[model samples]
Target chain A: MDIIVPIKQVPETSNVKMDPETGTMIRDGVGTVVNPLDLYAIETALRLKEAHGGIVTALTMGPSPAVKALREAIAMGCDEAVFISDRSFGGADSWATSYTIAQAIKQAGRYDLIICGERATDGDTGQVGPGIAAWLDLPLATYVASVTTLPGADAPVGLSVERLVEEGYQILELPLPALLTVVKEIGSPRLPTLRGKKRAKVTEIPLFNAQNLELDPAFIGLKGSPTKVVKVATPKVMRSGTVVRAHDEAEIALAVDRLLAFLDERGLLPRGDRP
Target chain B: MSFVWTLAEQHGGRLKDVSFELLSRGRALADKLDTKLASVVIGDGVSPEQLEALIRRGADEVYAIMDPRLAHFVCETYSNILSHLVKTYQPTIILAAATSMGRTVMPHVAVRVHTGLTADCTELDIEPGTGNLLQTRPAIGGNIMATIKTPQHRPQMATVRPKSSRPLPEDATRVGKVIEVPLIESLIDERVRVTGYRTDTADFVNLEEADVVIAGGRGMKKAEHFGMLHDIAGVFGGVVGASRDAIDRGWLGYSHQIGLSGKTISPRLILTAGISGSIQFLAGIKTSETIVSINTDPDAGLHKVADFGIVGDLFEVLPELQRRLHEHAAAPPAATTATADDERPDERQREERV
Candidate 1:
């Protein structure tokens, strides 16, 4: 099995906050890190490779800095890394992003399985994996929690997976050359080892640009993306907070009374016997 | 007349509540555009009764595509059908509930129809001059809100967040046209088959659909601290949710996580503890009717949007809230119906136990 994991570098979200009074964004600093869930994807690929004996490749699409994320993936046990970075790839939505990545994959060669995080934190759009599968005309499963090759697999033809759904989880089987967007239930990602880190430092990641990949210029970036963000502003904060104060045990009880009154005013709690 | 189409989703022969909500919103938008509000119902064994119910719920016309092949939502099949419908009808606007099915199918249809789709929109409006659909949604992990428009594409499409709008009251006297379309078996492409479904009943928290959600963040400190949230949520007949921090810390599972990276939820009431309100996490709970925050930090950004804020330790506050809830629960049930049960009163229990 040749496993490929797609990772992304996203602006760290912890430092992003809303300035309460002004209702504006307060970005302490825009620090980038590997999209947290993609770590799980890389780990899943590494574990699959460790069990089934194959090369695990970490692939990312972004600017040059994204190579660092791929290197981090290599540090986490990926055999090789590829960066699909180009000026033409900037401002691509899920549609074009998937197309560009799928083209990059075609250039990278064959793989038995492709893994991605269920969604990217920055975009929060879980469409890229399925979009890539759609673009590639491959079987796809989203929100996969567990994956296992069919028993007695002679160069395994298919894999079974437990996929999350609205009502519950569903068991699904898809043939090889399949794509899976995984949730955290897959497993906890393993940390990088000293040897792996040393290997990562020395490895030079190959880059694939639109020109190199021979992608149609029309389908590569902002021009190719169907949807456009016309406007962006702070979301209106409509509610006003009424802070409750309590210092001691007596004050705490009074705070509870005030809370109950508030709930009653909201018709949340049943109106009990009271004056 | 041009039409505003809402995809009415059904599961196990019952229409999802969000369908009605969509129809209601679609009807309003249709009226604004001087067009008809039509609902597209695609499923196995869809009944005339269901179609009529859709009319009562605000659809002026219901297009019924009954096919066993579509019984289970195969994204390809549904998207194909929808894209074909769009091509034929050329409806100006198409809307669906931002549920699992909508999220999966809409993009495929958009790509096929060569149109644009804004996903998980919290607000939708039409531009007066251009007549383009203005889709406003939280983006960049909810740090900023973006208004998107498909000015060049016909049949402007969007998936509205479920529970963001209220469904109109049913009017039995309402009459509508029902057009039945024959299902083309050859069009369905189902590469994946659902073999079995495993419902996590014991500890499953459908955070998105929950009425009351008690969530915890890194301030809880450890996995065991979630016990307090669980106990409090249980008392309120709600579910427990977690911030991405809690899940990242391995204190909770992803299923319990509410955030940009986890799941988007719009519960009735959400009380978050120890959460400092990262924009990503706040996106998930933005639609909650009542947001109450309890954290030791007074400047915790959560207090900004929170309807009620208690600047206190979770250990101290949770116990106090729990005690008050217990006292409230001990009081007699409300005169109308059981107030202690989960919101919407589990229909199964009503049939089995009531």
Candidate 2:
């Protein structure tokens, strides 16, 4: 099996906070890291390669700084890396991003499976994986929690996986050359080894641009994206109620009493307690 | 003629609540645009009453596509049917609840029809002059809200978060049309097959339907501390919920999680302890009727949004609250008035010792 895992570099969302006074994002000191979730996808690919014997390739689409993400993936044990970067790909939505990545995947030759993180932290859409599957006309599964079965020399040429749904879990079977978007339940990601880090530092990562991929100018970037962000603003703060400083035991009792009174006023206390 | 369409979602032969919620919102949009509001449902055993219910909940028309193959959700087959309908009818806007099924299928349909799709929109509106569907959603982990538009795409699509809005009350006297559309054979794709489904017994608490939710977060420190939350919930006949932080730490199952990536809940009253309230967690509980937060940090974000904020150690506060609640539940009906006074001296003594 030849596996390809698509990864992204994203700002540490936990560190991205809103400036209380200005109501603007405080991105000054926040640094970019390989989207934490994508680490699971890379680990899944590496584990599959170790078990079934295949080459695991890390693929990414972003500005040149994204090469750092690919190197990190290599350090986590990916066999090779493919980087797709260009000025034209800026401002792309999920649709256009998936289109360009699909084109890149096509140019990277053959692959039996593609894996992606369930969603990116910044976009939080979980659309790109399915969008890419649509662009490539490949069977796709999202929120896969576990890979129950994989095709091997003795097994059939299909894959079975467990998908995490709202109600429960669904066991699904799909043919080879399918795409899966994985959740955290898949497995805990592993740290990089010294040898793997050494290999990653010197590995040559080939780059694919729109010109080389022969992507149509009309379907590559901002011009090609159908959805446009017309306006962005800080979410309105809805509540500015009382904040009690309960430093002493007396204050704690008073705070608890206030909560009970509030609940009582709303008739939200337990039925027996409602007067 | 162009119309506003809502893809009604169903499971086990019943329409989901979000389906009606979409129609409730779509009804307003359709009226603003001076167009019809239609609902499309694809399932195996949809009854006539279910179709009529859609109409009573504000759908001008309900399109039913019944097939045994659609008894289970397959994105390829469902998107093919929807893409075909979009191409044939050319609706002006399409709305779906951002549930697992909606999120899975809408993207494929949008791609097939060459349109734009906004996911998990908290607000939807019709632009005043141009009549575009305005999609407002949280981005960058809910640090910012962005309003999006699809100027060139027909059947402009967006998925609204479930529980963000309430469904309009059903009007039994109202009447509308029900059109049963035949499922085309070619639309069915057999590439992926769902073999089985297993309910997670560990997540038996129906957090979404709980009238009262008591949640804990990282400040709880360890999984064992969640027991206090559970005890408090038991006193109120409620369920225990957890923030993403607690869930990520394996302190609670995902089903009890309240956040952007987990379940959105709108309980009548929610009491959270130790939770700093990340925006993602706020998104899930913003629709809650009332919020009370207890945290050690005075500046925790949750305090900004909570109706009642207590700056105290959850470790001490939770145990005290739990004991008080149990006492309240056990107190005689006549003694309820004196319960506060009865506990005041004991609480003060305990605090002074600390």
Which candidate has the highest lDDT of all?
Answer: 2
Tens digit of per-residue lDDT, candidate 2, span B1-354:
599999998776777767877987899899999999999999989789889989988999998999988988888888889999999989999999787788888887888888999998888999999999999987776667878899998989998877567677768888899999999999999999988877746654556545689999999999998889888988777789999899889988766888766666777789999999887788778767789999999889899999999999987777777767777777555545344432222223222321
What candidate 1 gets wrong by more than 4 Å, as runs, is A14-29, A151-153, A236-239, A270-275, B45-47, B218-236, B245-252, B274-280, B313-320, B326-354
Model 2 residue pairs with clashes: none
What is candidate 1's lDDT per residue for A58-123, written digit by digit as tens?
A: 999987767888888888899998899898788787778888998888889879999999777767
> On residues B66-130, what C-alpha lDDT tens digit does candidate 1 reach at each position?
87667777676787789889998999999988877787777667767767778888888888978
* Local distance difference test values of all predictions, in order: 0.79, 0.83
Give the alpha carbon lDDT tens digit for every residue of A1-275 in model 2.
78999999887654466545433344456788888778889988887778777899999998888799999999989999999999889778888998899999999999989999988877778888889888888888887878855555764367898877756777889988899999777888999899999999999999999768979889878889999888877766668678897888898888888877788787666534542
The docking category that best describes candidate 1 is: acceptable
